[model samples]
Target: MRKTAPKKRRWSSGGLAAKQFSAKMANNEKCETKPEQSEKNEVLEELNSQKRKFDKIAEKLQSIEETVSKIAKLNDDEEKSMMKFKEQIESLEKSNLLNDRSNEKLVTRKSFVVKYVFENLEKYKFDISKEEEHFSMNWHMEMQKNNGYLGIYLFAEPIPPFNDDWSIEAKLEFKMIGKNNSSVIKTGEGIFEGLDGNGFDDFLKWEEMREDYLIDNKLTVEVNVEILKRTGFGKNNIREFDESQKEVSDVILVVQDTKFYVQKMYLALQSSYFKALFFGKFNESEKSEIELKDIEADDFQNFLELIHGESSVDDDTVTGILNLADMYDSPTAIRRCEEFLLKKSKKSTVQKLQLALRCNLEHLKNKCLSKITTISDIKSIMAANLPEMDLSTSQALLQKSLGFWDE
Candidate 1:
């Protein structure tokens, strides 16, 4: 019975179908699971690659951060250096400015010393009569106290006028004589133009100049003047006259044994005294010869030369001519004298003040008073020539010193 049953082993339909379906499901599950695993492996590999890329980017970012930090520190250091450089430049500029101010002050002081020394010396004259030109030279010495330097001021005056639109070129040679007379201590040369006054000043060390130059506390100077060139206007326009032609005298006047044969009209035009004598009601109107008194012959000659524009009036002779001009009532000559005295008053303050008071010259009096700035200056004036001052003049000076007026 068991053998027959085995041979004909029968199964239920539902049960067999169920078993097949289970096996098929199991195989399908295996296949689906294999593809899914493969896909997950691929996804995992991609994720790993992305993670490595991110790490590399992080490293690059770290390197960039370090470079930026270095740049920031360098910029800070540069800014600090710039601040220090600016401070140094400012300090240097301040130092330069101070030096400039100091130099300017030094220049001003030097100029003041030069001017003061030049104006306070007595001048010496050189006789240039042999030149036959209307040229005169005067010189003075200035001794610098601080530097022991000697300054020689050479002044040339009465430069003769040239033709119209013409100028005269003058060349001068100056020499300093040694104690032995024949030796030359120093020499200089200069050239100038025009017919006005011209001058030159030179400074030399006192130690260097005193050894062979000083003799009896005196220094001798010689100058040679030459007309280097005459420019403008033709030569034919220059008038040449003989002695007889130049002597076109219409009147003769005598002063202290000196005779001046001059044109009456010119004299009348220049002097009120001459005008009253020749043109006004005076006994000498018809006289051919006139005699004058209280005038020096040389001073009168200088006055004549001044009116004729042939000479220059200097401080040495200005006061005498001023008196003569006042006597003759010649306003032009009086004004010229006043101007000359005003220039010389810087060195002769007390004398000028007395003269101003005596002559009642208001402008000159004011100038002299203005120069007296301190008590020491007033004391100096009093010590020099206080006895010469009149009562009214002394009172005025006292009032000025007491602050009664502003100079």
Candidate 2:
């Protein structure tokens, strides 16, 4: 027992207690500490703020895409408008360069028909037609029997205070319509200045005309004229649109040296060209005075007058007004011109057909085609403008003309 005690004399109970306490303190030091609730809340708030910023950036990108699409559409529209304007300019330049008669004065034309009932084929008193104004001058037809023949004449009954040196180069045609729509046609060309008339003294032998053309002793005579040239009879104005109209007008339309004061809305209502000019994005839209090119002042006056419900439509002014209407794309003015040409106009059939074809007047074209009942009518229309006549029109006239071959 004494030997075992000396060999194992290494540890005491106090030392064992001290070592266990040290080990426990080291384990407590190695344990991790938890984070504060305030730090966790701050991290969550930061993540939320970053997500909101990313959402805002995405919205901005979508808005930018829409803006780019609108800009692209606008660019395409602008390019198309530029191309159309370029084509129009090229067409005008070509016309000016190639056509010497681009600015040539328009010819004045008229026609009148009369019926004379004769008791016998003998010399009778002069029968005349009511005077009609043409080329700003009065003209009439006179007929009489002389030397067993029916004589017809054309007279220029100009209004007084006339030009002392005025002269008109006229192409005249006279016809005597008979039963079955047959006639004797005579043509003449001359100059008329100061007279009421001049024509054939012996148009045809009265005996032969009575046998072939007279119906119940009635003679239907027609006269047509073309005023090719004139001098000293310059342009005249029917309505004055100067400063006198400034009180009620919104703008000034300047043509050459003439000024026309007018309201923009009134013109825009009747014309597409004026609508674009006054309201569209144009350089001249904001200007107080706009100059109209390639148009006559007198024609503008007539156009305005017709729009204002005045009787400004006549052969002397009809063609010019129509040209202006077509150029300006004015429907009211075009309809007015068409009505005048259709109803009370004294224009020749060939002349009317030519205008209908050029201006695309459907009603007038149909009316003219319906009245073409003779081979002579076909020949005249063909000779006037065969290039412009369409296939359907050519066919219709040809079919009608076949009926008159034996006549």
Candidate 3:
């Protein structure tokens, strides 16, 4: 059963007021005033009833306002939740794309190998390998012999221009070779960023390795690192150059053992190098495969994609693509790179000037040199790693510096 509030006695006050009024009239002998007093009491009771109704209406208005405010707050919370969900989805997509697969469009699958040689294993306490340059970064190894266990550590000595907030994922294989053609191989993977490194302290038992794997008091271990991913140095590839489109591809150009499959006439029309090799008297014209030397496969891929009307050049890859484009005499590729550098690139003025001078990009060269109005600007451009600037460019900068001092 439902329970409700007790009822209020509203009629007692009006009855008491009427009795008091009648007593005052009887004592004053004003029987004729009784009618007027009754009318006045009626009006007072009506006003009290109207006041109660007003109080009830005010309470309802307050409740309605509270309800509206709560609804508005709920709407805001739902919008915030939706925005957070969208951000999480985007972040997950980026992680999924880069985690498992190494992108071919912006890569060199094979990094260099360095061998660490140990001699007289029982005599030396600790040894290290000479640092070698791979992927434009230094790498070496450190070995420690402790308590009948050998600790092996491979490190990527982070170098300049990549020292800040940079990271690389590499698949590593370390092999310990024996004199009798037997080997103990250890394979691992690591992500090198900042001060964090990876290694195995108890890599092998020293006694057994020295007894079985020693070669006349010497041991040779090979370390191979293949970089799978890199970040914070601008390695994004906007276009794909996969050769799986085999039905349209005619030949594969191999660079440093990396293959790029493409059509002959498409490249031949864009570059004289391909034209002469594919259609001219060269032996490569008749062959289905060719080798390009002293070039990065990633750069070549971006260069080919750019010539085919793909936007693939950026600050990190513009230099390499220009190097190949200038070598192969691809006019369209050169123009596109020059245009990007002049208008869109965020490279420093000094760096852009050097690239302009080296590639003989006349339009870019003039624009960069013209931007150099002060002596300090000229000094900065000169101090950078600049190739031999042509005579005309040198004269222009010299004249600009002298003119600035005079002004």
Clashing pairs in 3: none
lDDT of 3 at 183: 68
lDDT of 2 by residue, 1-407 (tens): 00001112222111111000010000112234324445334333333444465567679989999986865676777868867888999777544431222243221222333333343433343465656555567666555665676666656655543578877766666666655545677666666765424466667677767776677666666666666555555345556678998999999999767789999999989887778778866676799999876566666788888887778888777887887777677788989899999998888777678777766799999999888775556655653433346545655664565455435
Q: Which 10-residue window in model 1 sums to the lowest lDDT? A: 17-26
Candidate that beats the other on TM-score, 1 or 3, i.e. the better one: 3
Whole-model lDDT, model 1: 0.47
Off by more than 4 A, model 3: 1-239
Inter-residue clash pairs, candidate 1:
none
Per-residue alpha-carbon lDDT of candidate 3 for residues 1-407, written as tens digits (9 for 90 to 100) = 00111113411111111000010000112223223334224333333444465567679989999986875676777868867887999777544432222231222244546676677455665666767555555676656664667666665655445537887877766677664456666666667665444455556688867876676677777776777766554345565556775678998889757677788999989987677677866566688888876556667878877998988887756877887777777899989999999999877676677677767788888888878766667655554424445556655665665576467
Ten residues in sequence with the least summed lDDT for candidate 3: 17-26
Cα lDDT, model 2, residue 262: 94
- Residue 143 in candidate 1, Cα distance off native in Å: 28
> Candidate 3 — what's its lDDT?
0.63
lDDT of 1 by residue, 21-107 (tens): 010000111112123334234333333444465567679989999986865676777868867888999777554542343343221
In model 2, which residue pairs have backbone atoms overlapping below 3 Å?
Answer: 155-196, 155-197
lDDT of 2 at 18: 7
lDDT of 3 at 372: 78
TM-score per candidate, in order? Answer: 0.37, 0.47, 0.45
By TM-score, is 1 or 2 better?
Answer: 2
